[model samples]
Target: MAITSANQLELLQTAEAVAREKMIDPELVIEAMEESLARAAKSRYGTEMDIRVSIDRKTGRATFTRIRTVVADEELENYQAELTVEQAKQYLSDPKIGDEIRDEVPPVEMGRIAAQSAKQVILQKVREAERDRQYEEFKDRAGTIINGVVKREEYGNVIVDIGRGEGILRRNEKIGRESYRNGDRIRCYIKDVRREARGPQIFLSRTAPEFMAELFKMEVPEIYDGIIEIKAVARDPGSRAKIAVVSYDGSIDPVGACVGMRGSRVQAVVNELQGEKIDIIPWNEDVPTFLVNALQPAEVSKVVLDEEAERIEVVVPDEQLSLAIGRRGQNVRLASQLTGLDIDIMTEEEESARRQKEFEERTQLFMDTLDLDEFFAQLLVAEGFTNLEEVAYVEVDELLVIDGVDEDTAAELQARARDHIDEMNRKALERAKELGVEQSLIDFEGLTPQMIEALAEDGVKTLEDFATCADWELAGGWTTVNGERVKDDGVLEKFDVSLGEAQDMVMTARIQLGWVDPAELESDEEAEDEDAVDTEEAGA
Candidate 1:
């Protein structure tokens, strides 16, 4: 075989045909051919020589050239491909280092072995070009829905022939008990696209919450038009799901729009999801109100939300408890997911008992801490005095408002409360010092003596140690691990310090230690505020 006139035109034709088959640019295939030819030429014309090849786009003529570079005397390592600057003077009037010299070379004859090697190189290049094309085509299509044909099953995973590429549907990503045979038409969410050593991997999913949102977008015109937006989605996949939607238009009801007339829109999505039951709820800015809507078909008697803890307590009538909790607690679980909160559901009777218990505990705390009689402590608890600190720091008028308490009696009560608190503080300070707490940490201004003792107990004895602590370390929080809520205990959590307060105190300590610049911090906060405002506006 040889690069003669008879086969020169065939090179361009072959490149065009292969490019058309792979849905890639013909120029890429031509470039691959040029390199393969160059490789073959190098094999015939001493492998040490830098040989190059170029094919004319219109004429399809293969041109071969030999190239050598003039380099410094010390850097001329390749005898055939590089020459010293002094040695290059024979070919040019003045040749400088880094100059490339080229001379036309005769194309090499391709023997059986050379032709075989050339063929393998072309095939490898074509395969790589095809992979690059496929990756480029599918990378932008992630987080979308696509239709494909089931190709085969491997180890409980389904492979789909998604036009131009194969997508893998992992066993765990499929709807429960869903099975597919060859050539079955399947619609799936493009969960991810990745370029790997073997090739590009397209991961498909049928259980993603985004799949339901996309289905609703396909079914409802309002959602497609952006008049109605899906604020949140929670799914048990193939069983039950909840979607929260809000409407930008006051005239349009988001839930009604998603549910469609006679449930047609929702029914279509349900059919596609293999009969997954869906609860369409209206979105609300108020988290508790939204949670009440999320746990539908079960009436809520009361809703108590602890914003700092991101926890909510829902009280329902005893008869509705089962309904609110659902079968296997699925209803409350989905509600928690939709609202992004930890939910504690209780019956009205249970809530009453819990409140009574709390009242008794507070009454006891006041009784023991203030040295007051049971009736007096109960009266203080009834007046919203839960702790000695409140009684100690409150105005005299507040204590006087309690029944059977005159000005003198109120004065004596406050005096007793203050003295008890002072004694406790003194004892806590002594204990903290004994535990090796530094004065710098004790004098940090926001922490009480009890808080200082707790910090010392946690090995945070210095101001630097306290500054290095994360906000969550000082404010207890709930974390999700393996799909279950886990509690993280904070040393200062018992002092009722919120996450914001912890952050403020930590930043203050950093500033005091010159670890942080307040002016820079102010600028960063201002920029963050602007970004948040921009994000909210874009989401709107």
Candidate 2:
């Protein structure tokens, strides 16, 4: 326990044993032991004095030293840790200011408290070293499959004993209806390795689609050898999964290779996944074709795509609708995920009926609103004038192409469309007022009557709500509309104001309420000038 000659060698031996056990560099262990011994020595050698200790790596011997800096009397910050010029000359004849001088300090007998303190320091160092080791070992292993034994369960979560460290498999990351017992061997995807205050936390996942893909890679040599590539994977966890694979070699069948002889390869993956059904399909560059493949056994009668909206309408035979949608919409959902497209499945009968209804509605809309005869309204509908907005916003030339519509008539139609929209806005403003929306927000320069209604409907009825709303929320940024992607452009589409004007209006509201500092809006001219000068100088 004491720093006696007999125990000095024992310290180095202990450090080596610890280093071996912890899988750390022996030199690191020796450094930790030296620091611990130095801390203990400080108690006897005057805590204010700079005392340090070193353990010879090869000889297993320890040395204690006291460090002092040679400083002029006027320059000295601490008398206990510094030596004056003349005093330092006693040890070093030519000692210079700011030069360090180290003298051998006699080894002190380690006291019981000092010994305990040393042990604590060594333990803290070892624990830190172990954490670094664990982090290093697993950080790059993220997304790879790891084999471990179930160590314990806490609150329905399983702790796995990975060889070098432990991994936590959260309840949500485990396959549904799957259970693990202590000491049972399991394979899991290393979802993440995070360094937390407690220690390094290696998170494991069994339900991740990557876990299944990795299982396939291990089972199929072609996938691992780069002959076959798994393009995309989607899973509903313990129920169903879809994988799209592509073959680099035209000769090799990727799906066949992944399925293996007699379904052995895919079946092995399914077994690990608690019998999660796997659909191995060929990856196609064409999105619609890929969607059809991802849907598998469902027969697609026709496919209609809306590129701007990024939605696909797939029509199947009446008998195949249930099959295409799968149980609880799982099949279509997985296919959507795999293809990165929103899929709308409908029976051929339903699709035809829906198209007819849309055409009739559009025809009626044009006839009633534009004062057009049934034939002309049908012509407008066929020309893609679905709503009054299209007619109002469309180019003059677009209406001229419609038969029986001259420039004069087109202008009249446009005027009527504007009048209709203005009426709608007037009604919307009235509705907003009835909903108790403040008149101040209704009259706001940047917001249209429609935007006001949208805000009031969402309970943003006051000036404070208007001021506090985020720009995205107020502007109605990008939104997924009926599985179709579209940008609402906030109030920009409804009002003539730009996005900047809308933002300024919000800021004005905040300023009126004194919610924000006005100084932040002021440009820092002096700072800008200095930055310009710096940039000029750097360029020169």
Candidate 3:
């Protein structure tokens, strides 16, 4: 069916209606019409042929014209080829070659095909204009909340009708436990505004972390007003969330302000989140304390920092262990993220056991390697040779020079000292691996392989040999060296050793060497009785 002049007017009216509905400027619609007509005319006509379309908004009249170039040669089409000056003179009195001639196509009332073409052009223009309009309207609203009605659902994503246009709430953006029905009222953060073929696309999100932050901004005046700053926020959407807050004004309580008076403020945020729990903890500069607070409902007794390990052991009561660790360790897991600490939770009993084990290990290591009796061990510490390695490695000349030895005593002590050193070195090397002492460290600081071989040439080869030496003998003897009086008391005090232990070891060494009988020492009282009778008879 051919479109008449009335049909063209009706198309113009429809364009105006769409323009009004989409909030697009009417001038843009008119420009689109002119462009579309120009395109259609160019397609129908040849490239070299010039065609133009003009519309009068006031009268709704549309006109089309065909333009041709006049040339001197017979090289053009769409007109009388190339008109000679004499031939052009027929159309115009002074027609010149190379001049353009424009002729109106019979005001062909737009036929049915042309009318349909114009209608499509106008509709496309309106749709594009509306898209641009919606894009402009919503672009500035990113990161803000908008209330919209659910318009429809497609492939599990909801289309929501915001005031100016529709926004998409993708399935992944919906709160985990919340569902929306068509026509349902929902509030979401405007995540993005995209321009598409149909119109502006406003993307709404209910699951973004910023969603919770925005709700708090609305509910907490302090945050909105910029007095309270939200440092960070982490959420397990629709279940629970943690927000770190700090207040600019020291007098204001950031957590309290966020929580509102009587829990009214935070509750509103929670309700918006569909009953998801919110923990409003005060931010602390102290990391240990802050982490303790972040794992809420868990009372921490103490925090042991293992900085090299990048972990902190949090001690809590037996009952609070689960709470501190949370279900499947979520509480501590989030707390680690929030506070940047690798947290390990332990009950008080576990911590105690760990400490006890460490102490026992150190004590056992001390006892096994130093071969000294408890009292002699204390004495070696007093004498500044606190460890077995230190005592065993001392030079005989150095020991002899220690303010207490005579030349004869020094010689006698050297043999015993050599034996002791050899024994200690042998034992140290044997136990090195079990004691966890590195071989390289032992070689570096104490006996090397060469030194051990040299000591083995002498008969001393175990810690027990070193343990038999008398403390007084080790410190030279009872005489002075280098003209200094041998202050036996001073040496004893220095080594923290008692005289009785020293005497016993001296006697034990004699017995071991078989120079004295244990029975003769025990029978000394009877020998004294016989000697007294013989002395009394001689005096008579």
Candidate 4:
């Protein structure tokens, strides 16, 4: 079983032949063998010994040698003893002190153990080299789509042979509701190219957001050229997706380009995605507009923003509510992500009610106080001034500047207008507090403590005030403190208070006084009159 000189030659030739067949460099194979020998020698011999392996490329011969120091003291037995001058001459002619000599030691015959050890080293080195090469080849391919053949399925992940290396297609990365078979040609995006002990760990993904982006880039020339940018994209994978596109040129429409003629361009991408619906929205600098577009196939009437809350209320038609919200709210949800807004979809009915309430409140404020005509009242309402505070805070000079009012009229109206506005505001604050409206709600209009107290005493405390008092009573009554009149009909007339304002004041007053029971007020007035008469007669 010993490897004679002839046997070593045959082994080296066999290794060379295998290297040629495998397209591996022979010198690398020899180096691997030498490294293996060094490892084996180190394992067998202690670190005190210097072991080296040498290989002759031309002859295909290899040798191992152990170098030792000549020491005066023999504490380390591995070090040969210092020889006398005459004894050194026997091995080296004219040897001097500290001189080293090389002696040809007989080659050790390596049996089955050495052969097995060398084979292991060669295989390990070859594998390591192959891994390093594969890592180098694939590292630059990240973020690109590559075609591969499905190799097999393991643990719900498809293994793909990407020519140079194998790539993993995780179950989650595969397009949902789609199937593939072994040997099927498929395209995937290279998510990552990682180095491992075996080889390059190429990760393939079919569900990455970049996959859609890349598809767009391929289908839209403007996108690749950077003329039209895909600002944002969101997807529900196989169901639907939304992409926001912006163009550098103001005249050019990014959405139109992406959609192509008859949607041929987007259709191409859609086909790739297995018939998934794609919505290409024109990106807008204004978030509200962008969000409206993001929620496609549904017309948006308005967008109410709650910036601090990061929420948006979108008003659409009753029929379009379901469409705007989409199945399971997918449309708005995706739109929210695409436009970076938290969207709440509302039907036209809800929106109409809200607008009607707002309009009534605004109209009441204007008609109740301001001397302006209906045209002016409507203008103020349109301008979003629906409360006394807005009018009270408006500068008199500005009011005078408004069309149809001269400086003299402006000054006179300004004083009375301000006083009326202040009185209404004060009454509203008091009414708000009296009606048990939370301090938080009261503060919504920036009402101060004094204003709240005044409004409460005047019975104009909260939104509930109108529910308690009749409109005529509120308009006719005066707000007093300690039997002293603080406000009267003159004050109310000064601002031309409208029916809505009168109603609100009355409701607020009733709520503040806590005297008007909603149940009684809500009951039939005739029945209450009969009951009162019967009680009076009984007492008599």
Please provide TM-scores, in order, for all candidate models, with all chains considered together: 0.93, 0.75, 0.59, 0.60
- Candidate 1 or 2, higher TM-score? 1
Candidate 1 residue-wise lDDT, 1-540, digit = tens: 778999889999999999999888899889988888898999998899999999999989999999999999988799999999898888888999889889899888889888888888888888888888889999999999999999999999999999999999999999997999999999999999999978899999999999999999999999999999999999999999999999999999888888889999999999999999999999999998999999998999999999878889999999999999999999999999999999999999999999999999999988887788999899998999878889888988898889999988888888988899899899999999999999899999899998998998899999999999999999988888999889999889988999999999999999999999999999999999999999999999
Q: What is the TM-score ranking, best to worst?
A: 1, 2, 4, 3
Model 2: per-residue Cα lDDT over 1-540, one tens digit each: 556667667777888899899998777777788899899888987889999998876676788898999988888777778989898888897989988898898887887899899889988889888899889988999999999999999999999999989999999999879888899999999999999988899999998888988999999999999999999999999999999999999999999999889999999998888888999999999888888898988999998886544679999999999999999999999998898777889999999899899999999988888787899889988998888988998999999998888999999999999998899899999999999998778776656788788788888888888898766555445577896556665433344444456678788999878887778655565678889999999999
Quickly count the clashes in candidate 1. Answer: 0
RMSD of each: 2.4, 7.2, 27.2, 21.3
Off by over 4 Å in 1: 72-74, 84-94, 459-465, 510-540
Displacement of the residue 529 alpha carbon in candidate 1, Å? 5.9
lDDT of 4 by residue, 1-540 (tens): 333567667757866876775556677777887777665665556555566677666665666676544434333354443444555667766666566655433344455786688789899877776677678878998998888999999988999999867999999998898788899998899999988755679999988878998999999999999999989988888888999899998888898999999999999999988888988888888888888788888999988886634578999988888889889988987898787666778888987888888887777767768666677777667766656565556776666656676777656655767788667667765665566665533643323545445445556544454345465443444454884334334223334454466665555456456767767766767788899999999999
Per-residue lDDT of 280 in model 4: 85
Error of 2 at 424 (Å): 12
Model 3 TM-score, 2 decimals = 0.59
Candidate 3 structure quality by residue, lDDT tens digits, 408-470: 654544444456557765765665444444333334322343333332333323334423545
* Global lDDT of model 3: 0.69
| TM-score: the better of candidates 1 and 3 | 1
Clashing pairs in 2: 475-490
Question: Model 3, residue 500: displacement in angstroms?
Answer: 60
Count steric clashes of candidate 3. 6
Off by over 4 Å in 3: 1-12, 57-59, 63-108, 196-200, 304-313, 340-342, 351-540
TM-score of model 2 (CA atoms): 0.75
